[model samples]
Target chain A: MKRFTRSLGLTACAFLALCGQTQAADDIPTIRVGWSIPAEEMKYWMMRRPDAFPDLGKQYRIAWTQFQGTAPMVQAMLSDAIDCSSQAPLSLGQGAASGGLQAYVLAQHVGERKGESFSVYWAVAEDSPVRSVADLKGRTVGVNVYGSGVYGQMAMILKQNGLDPERDIRLVETGFPGSEAALRAGRVDAAVMNQPFALRAESKGGIRKLFSLTDLMPNTVHIFEVCRKDFTDAHPELVKRYVKDLRTAMALAREDRAETLKVVSEVTRAPVDLLDGYLLTDKDFARSADARPDFEAIQQMLDQYQQLGMLPAKVDVAQFRRDDLIQ
Target chain B: MSAQAILQRLGAPLTVLVLLTLWELAARALALDGFPTATESLAQLPAILFDGQSLQSIGASLARMFAGIGLALLVAVPAGLAMGRNPTLARMLNPLLSAAYPVPKAALMPMVMLWFGVGDLSKILVIFLGVSLPLLYHSYHGAARLDDKLLWSAAAMGMRAPARLLRITLPGALPEVLLGCRVGLAMALIVMISSEMIARQSGAGDLLFNALDMALYPDVYAMIVILAALGFALDWAFEHLRLRLVHWAEPRQDAASGGNS
Candidate 1:
């Protein structure tokens, strides 16, 4: 039996090797890019814009994957399925610790200091008499899945509002659109959300923002671009091109609001006017040079999160943030 | 039937009412954030019924779920029968099965994405992989449980080797096979959601994830309710088909007939 199994294994390995060799001939040092949002978002925003994604268009055929959240997108990069994807601050912190992947976060938000406040907002039904966080005690507050931006932001928001999340509000892991509906239906008291859903709720008089997490945790890193260490090592030039394209796209988005809004609205399926008012005008990502928060601050917050028994299976998150990507 | 009997006859609807009542109490008492009270969902059911995108998402999930289950059934039942009939082959594959017995089927999803790309194939394969196990095991055991006397009797009666094997062995195994089918059906729905939750950009799972992203608790519950219904409906269809075909073989059997469960 052992001999038979051994023979079978050898045959399978040899066949795989031969197939891989044939396929490798076509590999051409390809780079795969995973995106949390659809890739269409980038193309629509950049195609006509100046120098944005030109490098991307030239050398790399970005394989845009719409991951549910940043958690597994980081996992995918860590596992070597792709070169880069969206990274969560907490997940990035954990990923950096174990030293498997070097990842970094550049501010991925569309920063709009003047336009609209697209930074995270928490809200409930407009008619609900819950005026302050104190009234939210023992009420259900909705968030996206655990360990996600929504979860962390909501927790932080609650804490800042003088409401201890662990003590006062029962945060439920309700999805975003569902959370909006729940608020409308008077199911949840509040939810931590981003545009245009928040704007949608507010516009309909369906919901109202009680507080913004942005106000609570200023410079609280929302999202970042995470990359693999090995990929960066093998093709530094390609990674550079990827970042350059992202920056260029971000720059064009800042320079050309009208065009950017049209494209973004098409890509995200958000109405142009709503997106113009909320997303394009409100939250624009500024290019952080190092593409990361300081290691100590990042580490400290994550450690606090871990100590709170929020993290499962500790990781070397520091190592996951490849400084070279930002450098 | 009398009025009391008619009301009693409306038992299925009554069960649904009890379920709704339970859901409402739980949602309110628990102060469920982002989850709809049962009555609210019922009130908003019209929006779901009228919405094109919701229907499309539901349809997309159903297609992936059914296609995956169908593929699994096609492969597992026959292979299981083959293994069941051939003891030598079954023993030879035992180690292969046991090697990865405890590994979470969902963990291999990234590998599936690498191999299949982030397309329908990855989701389908995930569902297929999840459903295949109990099926292969149960059906193999079912085949083995067949009466050796029946096999000998058919052989003695001068039935052709293939015909004797097929007619006696397969029917004897059908009940166990149907049980495997039930297990596989339930598993397919679960893994389909999980796989879609992981890499899929559309489908009911994706819809649910999107709702979560937007913190739309009501839509999330709506999608979940839709998912649960899909599972129940699939299970019922399988049960119905199984009962129609195999109930005759139950104890006190006096006649041989071909029927759907």
Candidate 2:
């Protein structure tokens, strides 16, 4: 009887100790970060290269959630499902304004840097008569989404070439995976394609790029990291640690391209052969060394979107911009 | 079992083998960039099933699918029976159901996620929405055709309204309810996969998209095969249960207007 009583007391003590540890750990915030596949989100792969993020487990931990697109990611933020995610400029404007979400930009993920980086392209078959944006007029073009950044870029190029994007081109919504197939099938004259797909098409030797996003919006911040206002309000220090770790990870990813692709391959399950020599190189979208979000470029994109009658109302980027987080 | 029955049992598997063979031929002939041969896709199946993450994802998806169907069964069956019996209730709900019928349930994922968060509840709810309509429609038709004389006889025996509903209407409508369940079962899987694909978080659908996004052609086709196999297995098991439950009901097949009782 005495031995049984002693064992029960020990178990009770152990349970109490565990509860105390949990309580202490709860004080350190774990940020729920959202990301999509094929975009090469560096922070999502940070755990694979733990040495890159010094403050990963010490100051803050990340609970990464994969999403299909930025639209759903924004929905997740609105519902408090995720605290932050890497968002495109168009989505950022729409999500904040429509959802009444106080989403703040923390740091840039990928963008055009001095016109020496990869951007989305509208490519056609090499034998096709279409050689420029104007030539695409009265032709059926393929876009992944109507209002996505890629689509916005395509629309801007079309407008500059004096063609109505809505009237002239019958924009078929071909998903990124099916873009090459759709183009090769003669279903589309040109398809707006992003990294890896663009690289794959290039390597295959039939597609000819007419114009890229850079041709229209030079030095554009295509994607940037964003956090919910509530998360930042409650856990400012955690957000700061996250930014610091993100910057460190970005710098390391830039330095060791081979190692970075290995981690990306592990996370995405894309064969390293497909990613190597292209991803994180000059062929990929440029990542800011210090992880800075360009407020001016973001505003310019929003203004252009508003002017093009895409956005319902004008969104001043300053309302959602947070310059304090990007150190 | 007799020889005829044995051959009948073997028919589906034989068809599957033939289809796979044809796929192999077509893929090899085309030799498209991202399309993989049938053998290559089948070779990837073992790896996918054995992987811990993949199994967990699929398991989570199945859990949600079942939960949604179970919830629909609980709510839709009784409501459909009541609607079937009462013309007023049927009149009220018919238009609403008709309106919602054409709206793809998967398209509601974003709004559902916004309301319920990107958790199991939201996914289950969308699957429930997808499944409920078919179950309700079939169950209502089943109950509507329940011989009024049989119900009247039960009433003459001093059976209360609720008791008659439980005892007579439920069993009478069950075959149709089960048929609805069969359709709902398929709808459940469709909604589950599509919602997961749209949400792109975790599940069989997410796994499929992940493979697609990564351009892992073999893995993509392998995931499709797994989903197809899962749908087939579930349908076969449910069909067996359905047959056993409605053994006395005269064999009836679906038609353009309605099936003969």
Candidate 3:
């Protein structure tokens, strides 16, 4: 009888301890963050540098999810699988236009800054006779995706060079990994590339740049941070902390090049020497210091997509513009 | 076993060796940095297997795949058997199956993910969807081709409808059902890899694409080799089990030679 009573008392204590741990874990809310690329997203940096994001595991915990592209992120947000994510301007506009998901821009991550080297470059075989964008007529050009900012830039550049983008040149879909090889193998006459690919291709000594994203639109906002409006409304404090952490990450990348490159190398699994030449430097894509969204630049991108007939209808940027959460 | 049997047993390994030789030759001739040679690719295998994260990804992928196919077999076999026995049921479900046949299961990831979230449930559901159709199609034909007289004899005896199905119809359809399972096994692996590639959360497919994204050419080819070897091993094991289960049935032509009904 004495042994049975003692065993019951021990079981009760164990149960209470388990319940307390469960309640404590439940108390700390998780912010499900989504990112497509490694170096391009803040999550990769935030993961390695915990000191920069002091509130990360304290006020809120981060649950990281990697996506194939920003387009899939729209659906993920619609399902509430991701509370916040990195977004391209085109995806954000489409998500808002679809009416099922309401995502608000929190800050800009990648944009064109004046006097800095452009991140995206259109390159062709160095030995080829095609020296200019005009020479790309009747030839095939490879872009990452059909309705991406890169494709839009290519179309606008072709138009600027007096060639019909649709009727004159053939556009093929190629991913960044295969784009350089495709260009080299004569599968694509020209390939649009950004950092790593562009840098690697240049180092290979056979690819020449024709034009860049900066040459077409100097101040266009390429990628930015976004959160669901409902999520922001529900947990405004967590959102604010997240935005603050993002700015801190950006500042860390800008101020400390060597440390940033180490973290990037760990995340991207690319050699530090290969990335040292461009990543987070003046040659890299510009990030906003204050985590502010450039509404005008975003509007310009939306207008460009609309003019290209990529977007069916005009999206008013005002509806999705919310930067109040950024400290 | 005779010499002929020994030679037949050695055929698959010999074919793999020839293919690898050709790949090595072509890779050397092309001299493309993107395409790594077979030896270089195979060298990366030890690292993948030894790494904790890669092993976890592979383990999770296999678990989901097995779960998906197990669920598929449970539901699809019964429905297909019923449809085969009843002309009216077959007529009702044929249109739906036909409409879904041509649609790529991987393309349904976005819709499935929207409803189920990007979790194990969504991945398993997509694989289930992919494996089900092939199983249903084959199992239906298997049951349909059963000898009516055998079923009739069992029914004429003291057997009920369910008992006749169990004793007579099931045995008669065993060969066809096993063939369906073979096809469904391939579909399960296909859907599992492609779905993981699309979702990019965690899996062998994600591991493969992550290598591609990082420009780890050798790692990418290594992953392909691993997946290919995995597929080949699975098919070989299943074929052994199938032969044991349906040893009485006459040998069918090779699956690659379009022997499938």
Candidate 4:
């Protein structure tokens, strides 16, 4: 009986020790920012520069986490596991309406105006009769899952080209990388592609660039930087500093075009010369210190995508936008 | 071996053609807005396949895959064989493997990134972790199932310990060991795609994610076909090798085993 009690006490002590270690892990000073970057890829692409962050992560601190997919990043922010990051604005808006996360749109990547469209193109075999997005009606078009920003952008593109995404094109969520390969294997007629990927598909002779999303939705659909409201409540200055530094980085990317090309090339592993032509949005990234994100324009895009059944109608997008986090 | 078998061998192309025809019908007849009409998807394949960048990415994926699997086998086989031979050693290391074995390697991507900087090393290690334990379990089980009397008889014949292990123990465990290899190979391919999807800058997995990001459905399909082909070839080769190497250990019901009887 004595041995049993002694062992039970020891077991209790061990469990307490483990609990203490986990709590200490939480207490360690960290700015737990989540980004939907492959961590290795980020180290290769963004952080190689000394000035990418002030004092190179010394002044404040960082505990950067990388998520495999944007969905998890969305969940992490809502659950308070993360404080700040950029994610698909469409998901963020819908998530906010449902009370899953309390976040607000704070920044933008202004690529749409400059022809730097984060677009999905209706591509076909070069010799095929499909000429533009119009010709693609009644054809299978690939997009990511329904609420994903990729589909919203694709829907806007299709709508502009005189085809309703709901009535004209067959939408299937075959998933990434697989979608492109499916197109080439003749499993699907056309799939949307991102930039380096679009460039990649074009280099192959069989596929032709049918139409880009920019041609359809110009300056309407884009990526956003959303922050957890509670984090903004606590470290407002840190968030401001992050924005100030990012604005400068975007500006540096433009003014020092040659050096920027070199850095992006090394980071992206694209040839430096090839990355030279890669597009950037100045109005979004190189914001004037006093400038605020264009929320009305953003809300319009959100509402359009929402009405298109791309985002939830329940999201009061006004609440999704917070000026509190803006520097 | 027969004409009917030959007909079966020629079925793959016919199947693909039949599938294409049905796809064409679906788009034409159903006015399907949800899928690509047949002809557009087929004509896009060849041009996408010959891409220099795409080919390079495939080659990169293959190289890393082999590197990860090869290093895992080198460590796993010998270590597993040793643990299989000695219960004392197995007991000592059992907890280490058990504690980690159930932790899904995919969930550890963030921790892996923190420690290994999200490079090739991290990716390889993640795949390695997923493969090694299954191989170890197989090795240990294979050893335990060995015919003890055979080893005893070999020792009675004055066979040296090393010679007995090589001639009797190894041959006895091979059937189970090969089964483990089949699983390990499939698992390796799966982890390769998952790791690339989660963490890497390039590879077929990266290609798929980028394709999704861009909404190039055709290109996404093309990558899927390539990865599928790669997996099929790997599995087929392993099966063929298994049949050839372990022919002597054919199941009791097989023609070879009957001949031996």
Clashing residue pairs in candidate 3 are none
lDDT of 1 at A15: 100
For B152-177, candidate 4 gives per-residue lDDT tens digits of: 89999899978866777677888777
Q: Candidate 3 lDDT, tens digit per residue, A36-117?
A: 6645646667877876777888788988777888888888998888898888888887777764568778877778787774
Ranking by DockQ: 2, 3, 1, 4
Q: Is candidate 1 or candidate 3 better by TM-score?
A: 3
Q: Candidate 3 on B1-261: residue-level lDDT in tens?
A: 998998799988899899999999999999887889999989999988997878988999999999999999899988888888889999999999999999999999888988888888989999999999988988889899887888888787879988877777778888888898899898898899988765656689767877778788888999888888899999999999999988879655675568766
lDDT order of candidates, best first? Answer: 2, 3, 1, 4
Residue A51 of model 1 has an lDDT of: 48
Q: Over the stretch A156-261, how does candidate 4's per-residue lDDT look in tens digits?
A: 7778778888888878776654555667767768876655455555666578777765564455434556678788767777767655555666556556667766
Per-model lDDT: 0.67, 0.85, 0.83, 0.65
Where does candidate 4 stray beyond 4 Å? A1-29, A36-46, A65-69, A78-82, A97-99, A114-135, A142-147, A156-164, A172-194, A197-217, A281-292, B1-129, B136-193, B199-261
Best by TM-score: 3
Q: Evaluate residue B210 in candidate 4 and report its C-alpha lDDT on the 0 to 100 scale.
A: 52
Clashing pairs in 2: none
Question: Candidate 1, what DockQ?
Answer: 0.25
Q: Please provide TM-scores, in order, for all candidate models, with all chains considered together.
A: 0.63, 0.88, 0.90, 0.55
| DockQ, prediction 3 | 0.49
Evaluation by lDDT, superior candidate among 2 and 4: 2
* Tens digit of per-residue lDDT, candidate 1, span A1-42: 999999999999999999998776565445676655522234
Find the candidate with the highest lDDT and give its number.
Answer: 2
